[model samples]
Target: MTKIIKSGSGKELADARGRLAPFLRDTLVGLNYAYYEPPGAQMLHNNAIFVRSHDYSEALSTEGEQPWKTPRLVSSGGTHLAGSLADLPYALAWVEQDFIVPESVQSLIWEDLVPSLLTGAVLPRWWRVTGNELHAVTLYQRAGEELLTASAKDEKLRQMVIDILSDRMLPQRSGRLEKALRAGRLDQVFPQIMPADTFYLASEFRRRFPNDAEHWGPAGKELDDLCHRFASEVSPERLSQDFGVPHPALAHSYSRELLNVKPFPTFQDYSSRLLAESWDSNNLYWARLTDEMGYPPVMLNRLVPQLTRRMVEKLFATNLDDWPAILRAMQETGEEFRLGKTASLPKSEATPGP
Candidate 1:
């Protein structure tokens, strides 16, 4: 007669321990278990033991000098035992009293007990737990799939996974990311690049501190004026030389007009171009680019306010000779030309208010 033998719980436990033993060994190595020795130069070399007491009468109480009068002993000692000697004093009282529980069985009990004891009344946040678990499982599955699927094929997917992991783990700052994005370098390098969620978060932060514009110092107002001039049909190359490279989109928008148009471009046209191109009317990109191009903030700060007025007059003047005259008039009058503030000029003749 043929008989079938069923695998017992002990067999299952053994299989689990076989899998977890390597990780446990690694953890022990990390904890410097090899160098660890008890106070009396006693080396722990045996399997872990666990003891349960139903009542205080069954539990052994110990103190001071020799906590365990009788040292715990395990059946067939190999490595270290990981249990309190006092808790299992009955088993320790006599080596013959202790029975061998499979390492797998011990591990299973430890796995349950540790989490149960550590996990108190409060549970980890659901999102955090889910994210960590999902990330781990995802990476594991991906690695397994890559190994299996790419064995007979090209190594593109495997390489991609490696690259992604390396890049994701690399230390990168969002400020640098923002700088790249704003300069359009990210889009240039990776054509499909989209602005990160961090950009919107930065925008929100700027919104919260609107007065940060004031702290931009003199450079901020100069950048605004330069952007206004560039948007109003001023030659981008000249502006680029004088101020800096206008934003690609902004420069493109301004260059669409006839080669030589008189009276330059209106502030309304400049404002419209800025709005249409989605460039920040208040926070111009040219100044940022100038700074990125290695111009010192302090020098740019001093130059920008003066340079914007010069560039505006240079662009708006009917003839090149008119610049000296306009500059002379500006020098004579305390009022700015852009603001239509001249000492001799009448209030009625000034540029109309919005």
Candidate 2:
């Protein structure tokens, strides 16, 4: 199914031999798998099998004077597997194996066992059996665009795609979000985008850890605890109904924002826009948007703390002149913050207890 004699330079052929394990070197002697250079004079046939590197440098290390076979094989690519070993870097061993092992047992090793050892194979049955949505989301990300595109076409992938979105467990952009939109299943996806508890969890995460660095304690045990607690409290049907789904307009706007539809404007305008949108639309209009589009309060509050000095500088400058005045206005009065429209802080309504 694949060409046995691929063309390569004689030097390249030599370099490939240098990388081979001693066991492989000894076993695969006199195998001229490559077509040499110099107009094909006397064929300087290399006595070693050369395969295209599939990041197998460690596997081919000669520390033990043998090919570095893994003790237990696990797929690096989660559920991504090629149709054949001939399609993989393992193809170098295909012809070579026949020389060492008998033909009768070759298919058993090359076809069945070797493919299982390579990446793109499904996760272990135990891992799948655990039914951890987070793990599934990880696998989905590792699968990358190939899995995502396939999800649009394949029924199993489509179902898995829906499940991933429905879980709403992934914090990062996992392409499941985009896939749901493209597949015209936003209705299924949007309702669960921010689970009811997500508002609390996201808010708590933001509140308890203003500095992002503090939240990540030694492999993220601190964050994991919060996530575990949130997971325990999540009830898909109940929370979806409580939080409610966004309107078509809000969903479209939010999705566009996530996908970054428009290019970023000039520094000041961008900064002003972010502050205005976050505080005005999200904070000041939280109640209104919740009523209008079923937006969670978390959406309103999440960006407030993010409007730091560093964020401003990253956009353009060290500081925007208007930011201090804006911050002062926000702190002084819990009202819509706009430039040059100052309002006195309103008095609190409290009845005196006699």
Candidate 3:
């Protein structure tokens, strides 16, 4: 078994610093290493990471003009890892010098994330804006260059769903997950982790009453909200599961807190899955599902938005087709959804799949 070193243990903070110091040996001489932890958004508060230099106190210093925009140092040691930090950079300077970004990759430093990193907001997850890249903020995996950012995870999840709904047999990617999604069963997805078939009833309740905030609360808002809760960091079971708890939204929020959101100057720093990272760039990540076999992107769009919306409304508001009429209407729209509530005769009279 491979052993890993942790940056923050109950062990003395000085010992933690001592353990981390050797990793910075090759970095600049005067460069100091700063470990960061954010003030979490626990009721009436906000979660944030602020950076300025290789020191935490200065990066978050209110004594200066604007503490919120301060530029803070990226921590060197991996949280639960144990090994050579030899390949890791000592400070933000090393992060800049060693940034590994792809030539074709685009940095999405919207108005919110970039300026914060410039002054001192050290975010640590998929969308975290850093000096040169929006990295996963990982440590143990970087020396080997196998970082799987959250955007990559979301893309994979989307692809997995499409693959399951494709209906036609193809190369098997995740057979179990595909099967579960096809049958609309979440219990099979993680039976061991989640012992009970809890969400099945909950999800049905939300679908039936999408706006029943009084009882369902946030889960009642949208199906996606329910999915975000139920479908947390599932692919990377161990690492992500550890971070998945508390709630769905909080699952990957602290990926950076676990490691540094380093700048990968090139694509080589990313995992092989980075090739699929182009999903966001394309307007239709689900285009293949729609174009090839005729499954529209989940979001309503100009191409055939009304058709999908009408189909959805009919599925809920209207009765099941007693004749071939509704079947023809569904066929015309080209959606993969089933008429679950379609009316049928008794078992003796009605023959299925006819």
Compared with the true structure, the alpha-carbon lDDT of candidate 1 equals 0.27
Task: Decide which is better by lDDT, 1 or 3.
Answer: 1
Q: Extract clashing residue pairs from model 1.
A: 45-79, 46-79
Q: Rate the local accuracy (lDDT) of all candidates.
A: 0.27, 0.28, 0.25
lDDT of 3 by residue, 324-347 (tens): 222233343333323323222111
Lowest lDDT 10-mer window, candidate 2? Answer: 116-125
* Poorly placed runs, candidate 1 (over 4 Å): 1-128, 135-139, 155-354
**Quality of model 2 by C-alpha lDDT:** 0.28
TM-score of each: 0.15, 0.17, 0.18
lDDT (tens digit, per residue) of candidate 2 on 1-354: 012125667776666666656547434431222311111111122321122222233334424333333222223533122122222322332222223322122221212211211110111111111223222222212222233344555665455544443333343333556566467564544433321222333333334444543323222343344335655332222222222222112232211111112111224423433322222111212222222232223332222222211111122122343222333322322223222122322222332111
Worst 10 residues of 1 by lDDT: 114-123
Error of 3 at 338 (Å): 39
The per-residue C-alpha lDDT of model 3 at residue 161 equals 33
